[model samples]
Target: MTDTPTTLVTATGDSAGKTAITVALARLAADQDSSVGYMKPKGTRLQSNVGKTLDQDPMLAREVLGLDAEMHQMEPVVYSPTFVEGAIRGTEDSEALRNRIREEYDDIAADHDQVFVEGGGSWTTGGVVDLTDVDVAELLNANVVLVAEYGSPNDLDDVLAAADAFGDRLAGVVFNKVSDDAFESLDQDGIPFLESKGVTVFGALPYEKELAGVTVGELADELGAELLTDASTDAFVERFLVGAMGGDEALRYFRRARDAAVITGGDRADVQTAALD
Candidate 1:
């Protein structure tokens, strides 16, 4: 905690607009003409190019925050697999490792007025990874905002599970990528169902292209995404699809890329096939 007394923002429950929330919060806070700062406390799976491992996501905040801050400060750890699970699984005494992590957290917490810390992935999605988002939030002393991806009525259980995860520090959760019909159902059944569990619904954002779309200017502004093809800054984009579809017919889709910006998520087999080609 710095002398400024910053409020830490941690969102973990399915990637669920975590990055978007980070950007939007910064955008909204900046719009208010306030001096707020951003940080991702931790990171995973950094990309290396030309012997340089780059922290892409946090770079977006640096550009938006208008701060000359380096990526190292925004994202403290950039390595394979998230650090939480990594620490929990090892025989290396969780208490000692936890202390080290907290030390790293306090070091950055000492910097800004209000630091927005984005949590990694979901809290409950566990496999061999034992430590979850709850651990991260608890260690960091941050409040939790769970974003429910279950847009339909049948997903009430999902919402309940998230509330249960947040426990005492549960601030307010939002339902994202909601459909029109689903939103209707959510208004009646879903919202009441969530309310019954004592969780407040903040705001539900529809699945919009703008969230994913990157105008060349926005792309350039975003230090995370690189523009393969050069274009004017004034150019705007419609939608960005990660993982280009494989097959000749699918490639033909790109022929109509006038207003579309294809953003393929690599490591996806279909994307690797189509995007690599």
Candidate 2:
């Protein structure tokens, strides 16, 4: 595959599902009997294992995708609190980090037909260490795929800005989390506009409520709240409604939404019941 073809999956903003798409593509290639590797060069989410702080995403990729690369090689520069603090204090070694990432990526790429490199949370992430997603893509000479959640007109602007930034390196764009109405607008106006501007639209994935949702247990853990009810932890929450309004208004809003998690005060029995019902 042209000596390990590499693709960098980046995004315009957080929660754009960059990792999901990267893994999906990797799995697809692997299922087709192609050797696929995965890496996340600069990671923000750190996990502590026996006092060794490791990046979470690459570990996920390695375990889930059965990647052959070692954990250290898959995740080269973990943005730990101390690491970032040291960078801020001018004690961090930027060149050393770059060398480590380049060396690991070279080794990983050498062993596979293609490698999927997952970028940081956002395009501008890791600027403190001079290793933004764009910088990484340029460093590795990888084709870029920018993922953006298509909700508003500003999303189109962000994708266009990414196209401007990446120029010829940009392979295409994947629009995610587009609702029915937004998809209609994007198919009619946004895709045509981007095409007119010489941008490649690879795919526009419609918003799937089940796939885009967070489980109730996940939400509880995120908020540090105890789940008091015996409701199923696997229940997905695609929308969150937070307020105390009149019964009619609440009913109207509840009826409009599917798989919603309503958060209100303890005394707001009306909203609570409305949500539960």
Candidate 3:
């Protein structure tokens, strides 16, 4: 492993905003005049680009961070169906894969003062290939920064469990997508409680609806939907509603929504008209 400081941004559960935290940390480091690099050792979300299969998160991070490393080095192992099947069938060589990831990471570390590695789904992800977030952190000799999304008090259990899993390698935890009440509770009670247990609470971020929103084009792409109107596809959609009720009811529901898309049958022109109205 290299002497350059490396940090693995992992999560307590799925969709825990690992990429967002990684990007944010990298940007912060860059703003401090530090050379920052990024990587996602095992990519779970696959997307095809120009006949090449790649992980979508790392691709977006590279563009957002403006890193010069090639995409292949940033995401070394993609957990495609074939790769998973081979691992299950005991046909893939785990050691060789690990070596490749290390080599790529070393290359990145050679030129940068800090390298931020974003973990797949969660800490236990990639167990099939023996490349979980914990495993990758140990392999790279990197410290862990676990990101957890707070829904209730029960979520603290997940953070404690992850702290146990990472041991001293875990630097701290960041609570993301927290509600107003939850944020106050965490600040007043939760942070002290976790610190008493030897787990550091870095920060609790308040929930921002706009940050969680998706563009209309992304929604259409996810649903394989066709746009029938000339409206801007770049508009951000914060939520969605179903227009299955009467025209008045649908209109009332639609009116209450902010930047939301309505889903209904194509034959129901009344519902469509209500949504439009």
Candidate 4:
């Protein structure tokens, strides 16, 4: 900690991959000889292992960023049972939670070179974290990195709203899962759209399935279904293309794929049949 401040990585919209981007950025800093500190300050909907809720992502960050402190200290609050319980009753106090989050953030931030603080969910989804990216950014008094999804009609609005909410604390935006077609959609309207709203498009990413992490078997577990093939266990895909192509197109790409997992919800007979085929 240099008595300055740390960087807070945030996202404006859903499925923006804030965690992945934050981890990647921290890894970048570590690569450049900076001892990076990472945190996902708030999170809900944890992955469960029997009675224990696994804090896998943060643990991974601790390993990758090479932290020496207690893992739980990095993330002081787990917005699982408590957050959901309050949210269900519609009695969750956003500002109060913000204060607690900030206090915890300040503590960890005091010792690290660059602490990367990530948010819980998108602007709309919140259980207990009391933070959208904007709220967290404001409370932390740190720079923001808004994760944006390309090809969405409301991307501009969401991104701008987050920046405006954070004001001077807002840094820039990184666009996630940006496909070639998505970029084409934004081609003419892209620069004007961002400039019109006073925002910067930091980086546009190609869709990577590994980031999603909801593998076939994992989806099977979540959906209460059995894996049809052993491939579901080991098939970690980097991306998924659904109806983007025709007969030859599907085979053309899938034929070259090795250990690609097929992830879809339960009772989607159409997808189940397709995967089986």
Q: Write the per-residue lDDT of candidate 1 for residues 1-277, one digit (tens) a residue.
A: 3443333444435456777777777677667766666666545435752223555667766776686656666665443444444546663455554555566556665654555666655555322333356676676666777767655566777667767866887787777877766777877777777777788888777776556456678767776756576656666676565445564644666655556555655555654454435
Summing lDDT over every window of 10 consecutive residues in candidate 4, give the lowest-scoring window: 43-52
CA deviation > 4 Å runs, candidate 1: 1-15, 30-34, 48-52, 79-97, 125-131, 214-277
Q: TM-score of every model?
A: 0.66, 0.77, 0.79, 0.69
lDDT by residue (tens digit), candidate 2, 1-277: 1346889999999878898899998999899998998999977677742235777778788888986678888888877677777789998787888888999988888888889999987888888878988888888888999999887777788898888988899999999888998988899889989999999889899888778789989889999998788968998988788857975678778888888888789898887777666
**Candidate that would win on lDDT:** 3
Each candidate's lDDT (Cα)?
0.61, 0.85, 0.89, 0.67
Please provide, for model 4 over 180-230, each residue's C-alpha lDDT reduced to its tens digit, 9 standing for 90 to 100: 778766656864678677777675777766664556666667779865555
Off by over 4 Å in 3: 48-52, 214-277
Model 4, TM vs. native: 0.69
Ranking by TM-score: 3, 2, 4, 1
Clash count list over all predictions:
4, 0, 0, 1
Per-residue CA lDDT of model 3 for 30-133, tens digit only, reads: 99999999999988778742234798899899899998899889989877777777789998788998999999999999999999999998899888888999
In model 4, the runs with Cα more than 4 Å from the true position are 49-52, 87-99, 127-129, 152-154, 208-277
- In candidate 2, stretches whose alpha carbon ends up further than 4 angstroms from where it belongs are 1-3, 48-51, 214-235, 238-277
TM-score for model 2?
0.77
